[model samples]
Target: MTVFILVAGAFTGPHVWRDTAARLAEEGAEVRFAALTGLGGRPGGPGETIDLETHVEDVVAVIDAVTADSGGEIVLVGHDYGIHPVLGAADRRARSIARIVHLDAGMPRDGVPALAAVPDPRLRVEVAERAAGELPPPARDAWPRWGSTAGLSEAALDGLTALAAPQPLGTLLQPLRLTGAVAAVPVTGVLCTGNGPGVEMLQMMVEVGDPALRALADARVAFFELPTGHWPMLSCPAALAETLIEAASGGGRRLTAADASRPPAHLRPFLLDVPERARERAGNTDLYLPDGPGPHPAVVFVHGGPVPAGARPTPRDWPTLTGYARHVAGQGAVGVTLDHRLHALTDYEFAAGDVADAVERVRADPRVDADRVALWFFSGGGPIAADWLTGPPAWLRCLAANYPVLAPLPAWGLADTRFHPVRAVSRAGRLPIVLVRAERESAEIAATVEEFLTEAARHRADVEVIDVPDGRHGFETLDPTDGAREAVHRAVGAVLARLKG
Candidate 1:
């Protein structure tokens, strides 16, 4: 018997698949059901972004555990927005996923949110009103022709009602970023036709008409259709199970336009083919223009450790810390995160004018709004930030540090004399300097820095101290933990606010 991991669509928990699981079992296929976080029993954790990432992680964790016990690759079937998590999960664990089936689900496209794939105007409006609440309606009717159901039975409606749940706002709003890993996975689509009854009718008449279902067919994903309504698991469980088994079998049939129309929305590949003009420079700097439009404000994100090594952007780090850059642009500001040279970015070099040169370079970029240039740093980069403040470029508006290692510590073999926080503050010529520190950090370490700031203040320096709750060193480092990211967000926010002001 083949093992199948079934994922339910947004707003639904595993309970929606009870009948399907039973039917699959009867057909000799071992079936397991899944519910996404914020939808099923899984509750949202503190500071959770309430976005696609949370949902994707939920499916990935489940698949990893299931595949471990199955001792081999397993078939993963997704329904509705469940396809988002399934495709993303497949990217990370492709080896363990043998076949992926979209059960009346939308496939992943770069930049397109799952909700954009829905075809019905009324359904789209309902999903949007439930999500953004304030989004204005489109000028044209967005509904599709599919699921113009002949009808459904009262009993089927009753069953669907027993199964449906309120979907989360985040599920519909968050955008999915597809990588090459998802593109390579073999996929199959199952489309349901004809209306069943009650909740089943609503599900078919609304969800089956989604543009994503048809869009999947255009991408050459294998497709099959069932002449039943929305809740086929309830109305035609045996038939849906048979189709799944057939798709799982070696030869999958092709899908037709008669099946579903392709969605106008398409995923642009995620990899940013860095242009020749944005080439790696100075043997230490790495530049990036994150996906999406911009006359974005430019801020250089100086990595804390490793020269040039700090230049390479880690995928895990990009979504968290640098998310602020994207946020800034969305707020109508230009944001640029950069890699600074590790060895030469010392107090002397920073003071000598490297900071000013970098700021000028950022201003030179046409995409950057030169008036909004700032410097953001973390840990080891903190001192560089201090020096930049002390000797900033003509256009540098502000500087912010996250748990900066500015407190003089001889343990690392660097004298407090060369990297004096107080001295750096004194040199900034009174530019706005924002310092954020973790409340949980050692008092001795933070106290020394505070004393320096106090001294700087006595000398009339523009310094703002924000004590981040439960912060730690390198708080800007994005981890699965909470407070760190929020601290980074707060720090980035401060820098952006000062520049925009």
Candidate 2:
């Protein structure tokens, strides 16, 4: 038996799920509805901070309340921002959940913040404006073109709206930590498409030009495309419910690569159910040991943004960090790729705790040749790598970074970050460094690394910069694209040669 738990998102309540939940119940499937803390009728007292932890607890409490049988694992269905709290709850209730279904939701992991993950300027500005607004009571009808019933009579819309309460500011304010949970449970996305205005709105907001979507398509997860707008539960209830049941019962068939190459379905992330074997967390970090007999040098590639490992369906054909690691492995070094906690688009650090953890974990790898292990970070991962290179685990031998945000710019990190590579190379100890900058990348990163190297020469640090043409910040792993795969392959070969010689 499988249990279903539907978690609501911002400006929504359990009522939004009333129709879908009722249908699932009719199928004799056990279902529960939960309102996020400070939203959907459960309001904190005046002056309550309503932080991220509080929202997580609200979901956890409901999970614990409903799972009285312990006979089955709960399948969590999250919509929109609800994905954050559900993910946090999943970590705490990893043992209790069978799988997670992200219905047009934000699926960032590793304490990454959602606001940071949104790349569209218009969307970013829109969310910021909404976030900054004072509390407005969220009503169902107020959702505006969210579901099929959006055009329903005024009375019905008002009824639905009345059921919703003001969303807590904390849900957006707090960062989520989900390294353990995502590793334990599988995640699936039920992508809504352009069937109507409601679905179109969601497509415009979340799916259109989303980096997450591209990342998802790159990962071969189980994805079912609903050509409706954001509220398929209301617009396409039968199809929505059918898909949910199919997912819960493991009845959905995998799409052929040919089928996936088509339009809407082709671009969608593969929706995969978590395998039963992955239900346990042997180690939060995944260290891929070489098949060779002797101790091998290992390099750890830290991911950027805030999505979790299982959230996106990474395709084997895709050019990605993992693809590069595979390249590294072919070169004879054990490639260790870790899914960092802060990369989950929901995590933010008041201190450098997350960065410190990544360094410690990589250095601890026995096969890594702690004395020789180097870091290759991308974008957000660069600053964290710098902290490690300059701060702790001072035994790092060399560094190879790509399209890295190395400048100690405040939005990304501290100001001194521009000088971190220099400091790591010049002051604490001299280390060999290979900096990969995209031709189209910001001149700031190139200028910063160059300035540091010149200054570091006084301390005699070795630094070399390679600018690859036609490359973008995330172009490396988007294999089958253009020059990214070839560039990455060449880069990996160079790293291997450097290590071997």
Candidate 3:
């Protein structure tokens, strides 16, 4: 039987999950309700010095206790504020967690606190107002004013109010610390569709490019819609139980190349014939060639990242880049995904040289139409390939960059240099370039892309700008949400069209 750990949101205790827990238990699943410190029956009370880490520890302790008792994997479920602590626990114990289910909860990113995740200014103000003076917890009776409890039966409302307690203000104020460990653990977002305007609000945030929401949309997290209010366990216990069961039973695993039963017939991996000088700096390249290849138009795929030193290549490393290469091959083109040596922030010039060598190798492939080769660069790779965009070979047909970081981040010791794309685009030749900008990228990147385009126009470079509505940076690699997938497809199509023309 699967072991389940259920965590309740703020101002609520394990009793809130009584119905859901009973249902799961009836199905022969072992359920453990985690009543966090300062709430439920745990020691500590309101006005105590409870911070986010304290609750994180509380949940981790529960996980450890349950693991000791059951000796099996755990399906951890968190709702509302509970998601923060659960994520912290999961990050600390990644191997012990089978899956994490967020039920109508706020998704917090690394270093972002729960309160800051709230997009509504008025709500934030209200929270601050409520926590003024002694940092007293919000009144339990006022819970209805903060979120929707509509559609809930009278008995459910009574049960919720009776069990609700005061939540620690520090939990919402303290930021979460994550080191990308949670990415290894599968996650599921259970959207409560009937929860007033919460669902629509979340969708709008995603469209506007909220980072946390965008991360939640990652390919790693599968989303399931449930027609219930915020308190689904109280209002729709049976349905929530079923969803939880599905999540625990492998519904949350992100799709990876290893998940493919057979290799794509059209795609094959190859080691580029790198020169002795470049061999040590070069990485293996994956080639996707269509059948009947007679000097086909080709695309060289440049992935984003100043990949850290000592990092080993894995099939999971660049899913989006490899996936896009296959798509290009399906369109009757030679798609080459190359791995170039990455350097520390100070050695970008060396990295760019590696990328240039990779490009040369791709152009030399017998199956490639040397004269019609195009280049596609993503994120950090944009700067490395910017030199080619500026003074591209006459044989180079087109260039495409997706959410490219055109300028060096001076804060990270990457000051403006001759290699900086934004600084060099003005000197670039009249190369036809397509820039795909994610609408919701960081302000720094957005400004850089805009500046690059402005400079390109000033230089009379033929550039086309494509704005991915509601798109996030690195959306291609994240969960395959409809919006993300559409953005990637559109960008690829635009680049292919420019190359074909």
Candidate 4:
């Protein structure tokens, strides 16, 4: 017999898991819903103050009672914010656990709070500004900030809003600590496709050879997909129940781990073989000046990443950035590369500031023409380009995007429109936009690129698209064909033509 303990996510309580719990129980499994403190009509404790540890204790109490009363193997299922407490409890009860399930939740690290998992940059900022002890759940209409409620009906949506609780700021602000023992437990991931990445998308992410994501490729991790929204219990309880049962039985898809011996596509040699130009290191930026430079037109190449803060050979040092910078310098223009604090999605504000400061620094340099300049963005860093598009500066000549994601991916569930370049492009009267599109781009990025062009068309924005039919996301280093090189040249030439006064 399998004993299952289900922990509900934030703004919800065990009541939210009623239908799913019943299904699991009917399937001959003993189900217990962990009532998170201060949620679902539960009495808010002394002073109404609760935290991650408080919830951790709540789940732990259930685990202890269930373990003490029954001898069956324990399977813990945590959804959304519930995963933190699940992890917290799992860390303590690793020896007693059988399988752990992460149901549309983040893989949190030790000392990282739940707030780190919040997708929107603006929400994170707003929470900080509030400085309140507890954070109230978003109102009914603002539910998308939590996750996509694509499949929820009107009644379910109403129930969600009505039963939502005030989340203690400490629950999000406080960090989760763990022991290494939890690594031994087998894990299953129940992916709600509507709210986040499906199994295929997750496999694609793991294939990128991101060390952080390599854990997903581990044999211990298995994945199950449900074609529903964040509220799986409320959307498709039967399918979710079936998936949970299969997950408990260890029947699911697995991701193939990337080869440890091989370097990731990005680390491979750059496609371009241009001569390395003399580099001038300034504040958070590197400048490559053209030969006989006298206030030469400057192109600031912005490298994108929600790159790890500790990621070595930073974005500015990457071959793609350096290659583009060198190529621009060889074309009798100054190429500038800058390091920004876009280590996470929430860091976009700081990254934009860094880009702004770098641009000012570049314009102030004697080698760069202050009046004639262009800004180019790459990959995930594309959204940061929204700053210049909404209001084109007098000196701004053009903007270029190379396989950039102009809008947020569906999985991010961000409500903030501040970083969305697709919406901002309409504000640019006739600012030249040279977009280098990769036909073989990732679906998430490609989808947004298509949306951006559609929006750009509606507003009659000045846009020129350069297509690379056989290119990939990071085609500069990933796809080393003549087409990739030509596309790069065309994009740069277009910017140069615009910069020519």
User: 56-82 in candidate 3: lDDT tens per residue?
Assistant: 999899889977887777989999888
Question: On residues 16-96, what C-alpha lDDT tens digit does candidate 4 reach at each position?
Answer: 888888899899999988887777536665676678998898888988998899978899999999999999998999988
lDDT of each: 0.58, 0.57, 0.70, 0.84
Ordering by lDDT? 4, 3, 1, 2
User: How does each model score on TM-score?
Assistant: 0.43, 0.45, 0.48, 0.79
Report the lDDT of model 4 for residue 57: 88
**lDDT score at residue 121, model 1, on the 0-100 scale:** 39
Task: Write down the TM-score for model 1.
Answer: 0.43
User: Model 4: which residue pairs collide?
Assistant: none
Which has the better lDDT: candidate 1, or candidate 2? 1
Candidate 1, which segments miss by more than 4 Å at Cα?
Answer: 45-49, 122-152, 195-220, 255-501
Model 2 scores a TM of: 0.45
The candidate that wins on lDDT is: 4
Q: Give each prediction's root-mean-square deviation over alpha carbons.
A: 22.7, 16.1, 13.6, 4.5
